[model samples]
Target: MTAAARYAALLQWLRSNDADISPKIDLQPSSRGGGYGAFLTEDAVEGELLFTIPRKTCITLADSIEDDACGEGFKALIETAGPGGNTVVMAGFMARERIRSLESQKPGSIVDDSSFGPYLATLPWERGMNNQEHVLYWDNKDIEKYLKGSMCYGEALDLRKEVDVAIRVLNTIVGKSIREFRGDYLDSGFQWPWEKAAQASEEKLKGPPEGLAEAVKGAFVCMLTRAFEDGDGDEEKLVPMLDMLQHSDEPNISHAMRKSDGAVEVRARQDLTAGQELLNQYRSELEETMPYHRFFTRFGFVPGIQEEMTNLFEDKSSIFFAQKAEI
Candidate 1:
């Protein structure tokens, strides 16, 4: 299916599930060059409601633990891993749901497409325009070549190791010895959704699926890059339309989850014109003040760094030397 079809399905499914989406806005290719963004189709005043995703539709850690297939295993994982396990459970849920989505496409299959399938279908597994490309996916060689001497270099290495461990943990849950294949999914022996056709029959393909690890990794990347904190708990939620907006320093939109019903709402922070691409500021004022290297390690991109004029790592080390000299 085309990207437009996938998006249309998402909106249709959302509205059917009681999400209140504004007629004035729609998802379109972002001019910012990072996949799609919500665009205002007509002029709107500040405080106008853009969208409200129902609480049930939000993908949460609770849902992961309650899931029939992996719930018990995930519960054990969380109990053992403590707070950090929340992220692991969510990523596992995403991986399971994605596989179910693919399975649901089969004729007369007992498995049904998950309610989260529509939204999951829209997610990018292989990075393209989507900001799905993250530092975690970078190789150690590249990390050393490009990030060396930068403050984030160590952070990047640590993140890579963490994900490797996470994948191993996920292996115990999925019952497959899934390995990461940096190359194409076909080379990895899995038929991804993007593949035109599977070389094997449906029955043969089900002989323990390939790429579960890759799916887990992709979901982990999504959780890191897209999820928003749920105010009630340590868990984060994958809020649908709200996450579609690209990040910016001067965002035209703001969002809050309603404490009463757990619904998430996004609104215009300023008067917006027709054709304006809605933007969201991922970090708060305090978060924005964090060290630039930490920011890059977390979000995969740094803001406001004029790389041509400054080497922040070198500059930082120079400042340290100067301070020592003064002593």
Candidate 2:
């Protein structure tokens, strides 16, 4: 199918399954188009399972590249995903298939079936604007040298194919959620606190997706907001999945990757209360500046005196109390 047709089909599939598979989430839109959060429905006790999102559902840029030469030990890494392989493998296969088909009639062509030329040609240029800025691009001379040094003609061809398939798969599965809500105005049907913050701020407050600000320079707030807005709708869904855990400087819920299953799981490190807000420290206090600059700069909420007081007696006091009530 054509790329446009394939995209339509994917969107249809998401919309059809929306009711059955949609996690109990509340969409909170910010002044910026894509700023929102997802909250848990029922109060979850500590160590409770908030949710599980399969890696297949979320796509990343690395998933698209067919170039095994791009990284060392690439073949072994691809084989590790098992027999059917993961999306990365699929991407490689697809890239090869496209390259092969083109090469059949054009044997002398520099762009044969094993090449990533076709897949790269079809990449969504607009969506990649932000990513291009972050990544280091290879010049033709560098690429030619690397490709020659990395593998034989046949092996290079195979790697390019794999890269194509991976990129396609990543684009297909990751952005499903956000695409569904595009072009719609904010709705109260959802009850997200961040949305409330956006409303409270008269839609002026905007923040980056969790974790992004720390990972990328000048990527703190507005850049993330725009990236999500421009990203494949499916990829943007990942934000809500992460947001559902809520926010805590000292999070009871911890993010962990289960290597055995390749699934990212949120496990309770400590017991929790039903109404207690779930939180994961977006930036580590130990690693970053005091009071966590990311939180205050992005969320428009700061750790107040109450947080300081809690820190002072947090170890000894079972419950935190405000100074006004201490009298």
Candidate 3:
């Protein structure tokens, strides 16, 4: 589908989300920047809840093990992962779901879709205006060219290695087919959804590793850029359209997970204009909290924090790192 068409489908699915929770926002091509953004059609006051997503609605690794979707061994793996291994656990869950979606689409079952299919459909597996084109997928040359000498270069490299290891570990536990399926899926330029990928599997493509690569990378991206800390536990979870709102240095909306119901809510940080795009600043206003290179590599764009600020504090990060390491 075209970019607009894809966004249209996503918007339709999001709109059908609980009317009381979903905000009245327009998903249009961003003139302010690349990809689609959430724009308010009506003026909203500061401190007002723009949207709220019930915690249970979110698809998390907790759901994966509990729902019996993942195998017992995989469930044990998730338990072992805990807080530090959120990426591995979530990635496994997503990979598992993709396989289930494939099975459901087979001959006799022909099931419609999974509970998270709509949300899964919205994930950016292929290159698009607002899809998966993370540093994890970047060719090494691109990394060297764009990120060399930057703070995030090493971090990005390390991240890619981590994902590679995660994929391999899953391969050992699940099957080599997951990796093979991912290889073929990547070879196909990542355009295929579950049904398309499933058809390829039928054609002798690997099965267990179906969607493994994308799922792991996608989960990691979401974890780094969008996932939230859940109140019920230390587990990180994603809140649909809320996660889709792009970040800014000075955001107009502030989001937090409600302690009462484990629901997440995004409130206006300031009075917003009727047609303004909802900006959600990913980091705190504390200048030291967000290093420019980290932002660029993690979210795939520089915050354009300006040269003066960079000059002032750039040396400090290295100094701090050295001190912290006592090097």
Candidate 4:
């Protein structure tokens, strides 16, 4: 199906399943930024559904790449994008023009298209907004870093070989194939609905083929196991909904997920007044260096750095490591 058709169908499905909540949502352009997020019209207590966006409604980097091996590179890039093991956990809003251009060109091929021809021909290009290319280039550098790093060496490799084996087996069990789209460059800027397309393209760069949920679960399991081995706790509990909530440092809501069925229940972390926008922190408090920096690094939003504004919670107790060591 064409990208437009697929998007329309997905929107229809969302509207149908979310009949009660759909009307409450205002998907119109956000003057604050170029992306979309949910907001509450009235007071909602803890454990409320807020709104449930179907899995199909969200997008992932895996959706754009054609090969499963690309995930290894992508994961590595994510890791390098931040400090040691505490990488930003949410997917960033990929620039629409860059994504379209990347998809159009064959991997490793020269840019035969015009200087601007390589860009996505979306409406934003016609307007005055600057096409952000640095983010993509940063991701590429991280991928290269991962390719060079090794988890094991020589006979030590034999001891850790099981992890690699597990990852390989999981890959086979949860493989996915994605379709590619060609990028076309047009005018530098445009208006209205055409601009909307640029926003959507950033969110939905590519679509996933069948079995993405299974694939995501399997990958999560493998990563969670490793985290546990490294003194990270029942990290398994955090895996399922990690991707569901997008990143924000100053989150308006707090959430707890039920592991049995991967159900996410959100609650207002603080008292909120009417017309107040809702936010949810995508990563653990221990990892975020500053509140807004999370938005700037991950979503490309300009949240100036402030050392005083660090993540609110941190468990300094060594009990977590002790528990993992006992395991």
Candidate 5:
């Protein structure tokens, strides 16, 4: 299917998800023509409900484990990891399921195969738009060229280190459980893509599925860009339409936990005129306001970052070649 067709399918899926996406807002390809965006079709006032998704439909570890399409491998991870591995479990579930979707794609197949494929399609998959900005996904040259001397440069360095440790923990600790739990899941056909990519380096004998490292990145990316607490303290979950909203330094939506249904509900923060893009407050405050380097490293764009900083990326290849990346 074309990108337009896929977007339509995702909208169709969202409409059928036992929730009400307000007709006042329409989901369409963003004006930038990269990922989808939510736009207002009619004027909306503060406290108006834009949509209300059921708590059950939200993707969580419990949902992943309950679904058979996720396979027994992911369920095993959940049973073994307990609270310590929620991030890994979510990552593995998404990665394996995503690979299944990719492998299942045909020359003209109009459908996505994974259980959550429709929702997944709404997210940005390529490097630049969202994933490339974060330090975890940065190429070495881009780091020096675009990120160095910025406030986020150090964070990019730190997150790169975190990915390294997460990969190590996934391989040494989680991989052991995965291997022992459902050894078949790690077989050649189902194994992640990292090992093949990692073979060029001296780390081949390290016994980690090079894919696990990438999975950690995938999980972290999902967490960084989307996950919100389910109002049960720090339990983060990925909500469908809510995750698709573009980030804005100055937001127009008010987010709150719905007491009645347990859904993270959003209301119009102020009066919104028709045809405006619905912006979600991602990070604000002097300390929390996302710096350009961190924005590039995490979400792929920096909204209103300085022109001098982004100019550095023009001279270098934006594609990051993954190695055992260390700062």
Candidate 6:
């Protein structure tokens, strides 16, 4: 399906699941170059509601833990791996659902559908928006080449290692608990770095499908770039519709989890005009000002960051790279 079809499907899915989307707001190709963003279809005053996504429609750790297909595996993963593994479980569940969605599309496989298939289908990674890739998906060599001596580089390396560890641990857990995730589900969906490297090197390894690791990493990339705190607590969630808004230094909209109904609500921070692109502040400046390197490393791009701020780090990293090369 084309991008427009996917967006339409998403809207349909959202409404079917009790999500309240404002007809005044629409999702469209973003001018910010991040693939997609929300735009205003009608003029609105400050604090006007843009949308409200029911909490159940939001992908959260609790929902992952209770999933029918992989809940037991997730329970075991979290119990064995502790709190940090919660993120892994969420990503793994999403990956599994995504894999299921793909399988359903194959000939003679109509039963292999995911409950959250439409939302998963709209994710940037699933849409082949390579430019929207998070830093965690970048090759280790490329990360070192560009940012070796910078603080972001170290953080990136650490995050990569963490993902590697999660992959190994989750693989073992899935092998022991989840039957549905055993064979093809583990081996298909989402290309990983190793798969990319193998394709680049023209090397093919014949064996059991090892794509589970790839699937998890792919979901992690999506989670990293899109998920946000639900305002209920530190538990982050992937809220549909709200996540489609592009980031801007001066945001026009803000979101909060409604205490009354457990819905995620988006409201205009300032008066909005018809045809204006909706923008969100990914992080709160009042809480903390994110540095350029950290923002770039975390979200894969530093949208709205000053050119000089980014270039200063690039110049420093270039000097550091040259100095290390001399060694």
TM-score, each model? 0.79, 0.32, 0.73, 0.35, 0.70, 0.81
| lDDT ranking of the models | 1, 6, 3, 5, 2, 4
Task: Give Cα-based local distance difference scores for all models.
Answer: 0.73, 0.35, 0.64, 0.33, 0.63, 0.72
- Candidate 4 stretches with Cα past 4 Å from truth are 1-11, 15-23, 53-134, 137-248, 283-327
Candidate 4: lDDT over CA atoms?
0.33
Instruction: Let me know the TM-score candidate 5 reaches against the reference structure.
Output: 0.70
Q: For every model in order, what is the number of clashing pairs?
A: 1, 24, 1, 9, 7, 2
lDDT of 4 by residue, 172-200 (tens): 22222122223222344566997867744
Candidate scoring better on lDDT of 1 and 5 = 1
Error of 4 at 256 (Å): 3.0
**Poorest 10 consecutive residues by lDDT, candidate 6:** 200-209
Q: In angstroms, how far off is 58's CA in candidate 5?
A: 2.5
Candidate achieving higher TM-score, 4 or 6: 6
Winner on TM-score (2 vs 3): 3
User: How does candidate 5 score on lDDT?
Assistant: 0.63
Clashing pairs in 4: 125-188, 125-189, 126-188, 126-189, 126-190, 127-188, 127-189, 127-190, 252-279
Locate the minimum summed-lDDT window of 10 residues in model 1.
176-185
lDDT string, candidate 2, 281-318, tens digits: 65555654433223332332233322422233333322
Can you list the residue pairs that collide in candidate 3?
178-209
Best by TM-score: 6
Please write out the lDDT profile of model 5 over residues 146-182, one tens digit for every residue: 6565555677788777667666644543444333333
Q: In angstroms, what RMSD does candidate 4 have relative to the true structure?
A: 16.7
**Model 6 lDDT per residue over 33-64, tens place:** 64667888889999998888998888889888
lDDT of 1 by residue, 174-252 (tens): 5331221211223445557756244323323444346666677778777877899856563688988888787787999
Count of clashing pairs, candidate 6:
2
Which parts of model 1 are misplaced by more than 4 Å?
106-111, 129-131, 176-209, 230-234, 285-289, 304-327
